[model samples]
Target: MISGNRSKAWRIISWVIASVLILPIFIMLGSGLSATTELFSHLWDTVLPTYVLNTLSLALIVAILSSLFGVTCAALITQTNIKAKNTLRWLLMLPLAMPAYLVAYLYTDLFDYAGPVQRFLRTTFNWNSPNDYWFFDIRTLFGAGVVISLVLFPYIYMLTRTAFEQQDQNLHRASRLLGLTTFQSFYKVGLPLARPAIVIAISLVLMETLADFATVQYFAVNTLTTAVYDTWLGYGDLSTANALASLLMLMVFLVVLFEQKARMNQRHQSNRPITSSHEIILTLPQQILASVFCWSLVILGFLLPLGLLVLMAIEYASLEQIDELVSTGFNSIELAVYTATIATIIALVLVLYKRLHKDKLKALPINVSGFGYAIPGTVLAMAMLATFGPLDNYINDLAANVGIEEPGLILSGTIFAIVFAFVVRFSAIANGTISGGVEQISASIDLAPPSLGVGRLKGILTVHIPLLKSSIFIAWLLVFVEAMKELPAVLLLRPFNFDTLSTQIYQLISDERLEQGAIGAILIVAFGLIPIIWLNRNEDKA
Candidate 1:
C-alpha cells in the first residue's frame, strides 16, 4: 500500500511539473490567437509581411548552404581518404562551439571597406575610391546566412558523418561488385541511405536559423525573431509581441512536424561497421582538394574567428573590463547553476516516473515536457511574460487585500522568471540525456531492489542514483553550458541592472565595442566547448 501511494504521488508530481512547464506556451498561443484583429491588421499593413518574408528567405538560404557545406564535409571525412582524417573529423565539430553572432561581428569587421582586407586590396591595386572595386557586403541577408551556416553546419556534419560511418558496408561492396565506381556507389547507395540524417540535420538548422535574433539584427536584416524582440521591448506592446512570437512558434512547430513526418517511414540501421578497406582512395590532386576543403571549414568556422578574439583580448585587455567581467561572470555562473539544478531535478523526476510507474499515461509527462526544446527562446520569453505578468499582479493584489507589503514583479521581473524560462527551454536536453542513461539500466534491477526489501524511494536513492551519477553530471553540465550561452530568453526576462556574460557581450557588440568585452566573449566560447569536447571524448571511447 505504501509503495502504491508513493507511486501515485510521483505520478501526480510529474504531471504537475509538466503542466507548469507547458502552461506558459498554451497561454502565449491562446493570447495571440485571441488578440484584437486591429493589432493584426496594423501589423499586416506595416512590417509584418516583410518580417515573414525575410524569415522564410533566411531559413531557406541557411538550409541550402548548411546542407551543402555539411554534407560535403561529412562525405569527405567518411568516404574519401582525406589526409589527417582523425584530426579533421573532430576539428569540423569545433565550429559548434562558436556562436553565430560572434562570427558575424568578426567577419564584418575583418572584411569591411575600412578594415584590413579591403585596405589591402586598395593598396595592392592603388585604387582610391569605392567605385574602383566592388566588394561583397558581409552585412546583407545572404551574408547572415553564410555566417550562421559556418557555426551551425557542424550539427549536420556531425550527424551525417556518423550516418555514413555506420552504413552497411555490404551494400557498398555489392555496388562495387557491380559497375559502380567509388563515387557512384556513394551517390547511389550511401547518400540515399543517409538521407534521413541529412533531413534531420537540416531541420535543426532551420529551427536555429528561425531562432536567430542577434545575427540578423546586427546585419539589419528583419526577421520574426527581431520583430518579436522589438515589439516587446522597443514598443512595449506585449500583445503584439505575443502575436509575433506565436507566429514564430507556429513556424517551428511546422518544422518539427516536417522532421517527424520525414523520418516516420525511414529506418536505416546496420550491423556492419565501416572499415579501412572501404574508404575511397583519391588521387594526389583529389587528396589535396579534399584536405583543403575539410581544413578550410575548420579554419573559417572556428580557428579564424577564435584567433581574432584572442588578438582582440591581447590588444584591448584592461583593468576596468576585467572588473566588469568578474561581475557579469558571477551572474552567468549563478544563473546557470539555478537553471541546471532545477532542470536536472525535473528531468530525473519525469524520467524516473515513466520508468517505474504502471500507469498507461506514464509517458505523457516526459513527452509534454520536451516540447519546449522546439520553442525558440524569443517565443519562450514572450510566453513567460504572458503567463507570469498577470500572476505577479494577482499576487500583489492579494497581498494588498491582506495588508501585506506588495512584492514588485517578483515572478516576472526578477531572476525567478529568467530561471524558469531557462528550465523550460532546456528541460529537453536533460530529459533526453537522463532518459538515455536510465534506459541503459536493466528492468530487472527494479525487481532486485524490491526483492531485497528496499522501498521504491530508498531503492532509487541508493541504487538508481549511484548508477545515474555519470548521466546526471552530464545532463547538468549540458544544461549549465546552454544556460550560460543562452541570450534571448535572459535578455527579455532579466531584472533591472542584471547582466550575464552573453548579454554583456551582446551589448558590447551592439555598441561596436566588443574589444572591451573580448575576455567575456572568450569565456562564453570556452563554456560552449565543454560539451563538444565531452561528446568527442565519449565518441572516441565508444
Candidate 2:
C-alpha cells in the first residue's frame, strides 16, 4: 500500500510537469478556434500562396544542397585519402557556427549593388551602373536558398562524418580485395551503412529550414514563417496566421512520422569501422581536386563573409562606440548563459526522470517539450501570449474576488516570459545532447544500482549523472549558442525595453542601420563558432 502511494504521487507529479510543458499548445489551439473568419479571408487573398510556394522551394533546395555537400565531404574524409582529412573534416563541419539568416545578411551586405564586390567590379570593368553587369541579386529565393545551405549543410556533414568514421575498416579492405573500386566500396558498403545517419541529419536540416524566418525575411523570399508574421502583424489576422502555422506544423508532423517509419524499417548490415587504418595516398590529380573542393567550400561558407564583417567592424570602430559594443557584448553573453543554464537544468531533469522511470507517463512530458523546436518562433510567441493573456486575467479576477489591489505578478510582459519561451523553444537541443550521452551508456550500468538495492533517484545521480558529464557540457554549449542567436521569440516575447543581441540586430536591420546590425551579427556568429571549433577538436581526438 505504501509503495502504491509513492508510485501514485510520482504519477501526479509527472502529470503536472507534462501539463505545464503542453499548456501553450492547448492555449494556442483554443484561442485559434475562437478567432474570426475575417482574419482568415484576408490572409487567403494576400501572401499565403506565395509563402507556401517559396517555403517549399527553399526547403527543397536547402535539403538537396546540404545532402550533396554533407554526403560528399563525409565520403572524401572518411572513405578515401583526402589530403589533410583532419583539417577538411573540421572545416566542413564549422559552418554550423554560422546561422542561415546571418549568412544571408552578411552575403547581401557584401555582394549587393552598393556593397564592395559590385563596386569593385564596376570600377575595374569601367561599367557605368547596376545594369552593366549581371551581378547576382542577393535578395531573391535563389540567394536565400544558397545562404541557408551554407550553414545548414554542417548538420548533415557532422552526422554523416560520424557515421563514416565509425564504420568497420575490414569491410573496405574486403571490398577492395574483391576487385571493387574505392568509389564502389563507398556506394555499396559505406553509403548504405551510413544511410540512417544521413537520413536523420537531412530530416533535421529540413526541420530547421522550415523553421527559419531570418534568412527568408531578409532576402524578401516569402516563406511560411514570414507569412505567419505577415498574416498576423501585416494583415491583422490571427486566425489565418494560426491556420497557416497549423499547416506548417502538420507538414513537420508528416515528415517526423515518415522518419519514425524509416527508422523502424532500417537494418544494421555492417558492424565494422570503415577507416580503422590510416587513409591510402591518393593520386596527384585526385589529391588536387580534393584540396580544391575543401578549400572552396571553406572559403565560401566561413572565410569570405567573416572577413567582410571584420572589415566593416574595423571601418566603424571609434573609441566612443567601443564602450557601447562592449556593453552589448556583455548583455549578449549574460543572456546566453542564463538561457543555457535554464534549458540544461530542465532537460537534465526530464532526461533523468525518463531514464529512471522509463514509463509512458514520464516520457510524454519530455517528448512534447522537445516539440518546441519544430514550431517556429512566431507560432511559439503567439502560443506564449495566448497562455499568459488569460492566466493574467484570471489572476486579476481572483484578486478582485478577494478584494486585493494588484495581481500583476503573473509573468505576462516580463523577462520571465521571454526566458520561459526560450526554455520551451530550445529544450530540444539540450534534450538531444543529454539523451545522446545517456544512450552511449551500457544498459548493464543502469541495472547496477537497482540490483544492489540503491533507489532509482540515487542511481541516476550517482551512476547516470557521473557518466554524462561530457554530454551535459555539450548540451550547455549548444543551448547557449542557440539562445544567443534566437530572434523571433525574443522579438515578440521580450519585455518593453529588453534587448538581446539577436533582437538588437533585428532592430538595426529593420531600420536600415546595416553597419550596426553587422557588428552584432558578427558577434553572434563568433560566439556560435566557439562550440563548433570545440566539437571539431573532439572529433579529431576521436
On lDDT, the candidate that comes out on top is 1
CA error at residue 441 for candidate 2, angstroms: 5.1
Candidate 1 lDDT, tens digit per residue, 312-383? 999999999999999999999999999999999999999988888887898999999999989899999999
Q: What are the clashing pairs of model 2?
A: 167-272, 167-273, 167-274, 168-272, 168-273, 168-274, 169-273
What TM-score fits each model? 0.97, 0.90
User: Which regions in candidate 2 have their CA more than 4 angstroms from the true location?
Assistant: 1-7, 169-179, 271-282, 319-323, 326-331, 358-362, 400-403, 406-410, 439-467, 517-519
- Name the regions of candidate 1 deviating beyond 4 angstroms: 1-6, 269-277
Q: Please give the range of 10 consecutive residues that has the lowest summed lDDT in model 1.
A: 1-10
Relative to the unseen true structure, what is the C-alpha lDDT of residue 411 in candidate 1, on a scale of 0 to 100?
95
Error of 2 at 247 (Å): 1.8
CA lDDT for candidate 1: 0.91
